[model samples]
Target: MQVKDGLTFQEVNAACGVKIVAPDLEKSIAGTTLHLANTKEQIENAETAIREEWRAIYEKMPIMCSVCKEISPRVEFIANCQKGNPCQVQ
Candidate 1:
């Protein structure tokens, strides 16, 4: 098995430069109105719930490019511009 850096709500916004429906999706499911996730499990569960809840709009979900800082698909953003790469758009 491969060791992976666990994904969290903050990581998604800070690292990925994109936003999800909620910071704590599970907490939202549990009647949490604030976008706060206490634990990693909560974060993971919340993310999963977001995915499931938005399954119908999964393809339509907005994915802001961390490279170009635009609300576009990484592939499409890179393809349109003659940049370095998706992760490194120089």
Candidate 2:
């Protein structure tokens, strides 16, 4: 699930742990860019509130392992830590 340059859409989605439901990938890309631009403008208009909301969301997200700081889901990370396994992304 490693995301790097020159990867396919599926690869990117796998890396990000998301799914695209759009019928057309190209149109989806364009629409997403446009939506992000619009959202950026809206956020600029309400920067304080948006920033606070984002901070709350970020704080609720799963954290990496305290031992090695590896990227993984919380359950897997705990299992690795309890088993004394190396911190690796599954």
For every model shown, what is its TM-score relative to the native structure? 0.25, 0.25
lDDT of 1 at 65: 73
lDDT (Cα, tens digit) per residue for candidate 2, span 1-90: 854544235224232545444446663323212222247767676666555665565555576666666676556556667998847545
Where in model 1 is the C-alpha error above 4 Å? Answer: 1-35, 58-90
How high is the lDDT of residue 2 in model 2? 52
Error of 2 at 57 (Å): 0.7
lDDT of 1 at 66: 60
lDDT of each structure? 0.54, 0.52
Best by lDDT: 1
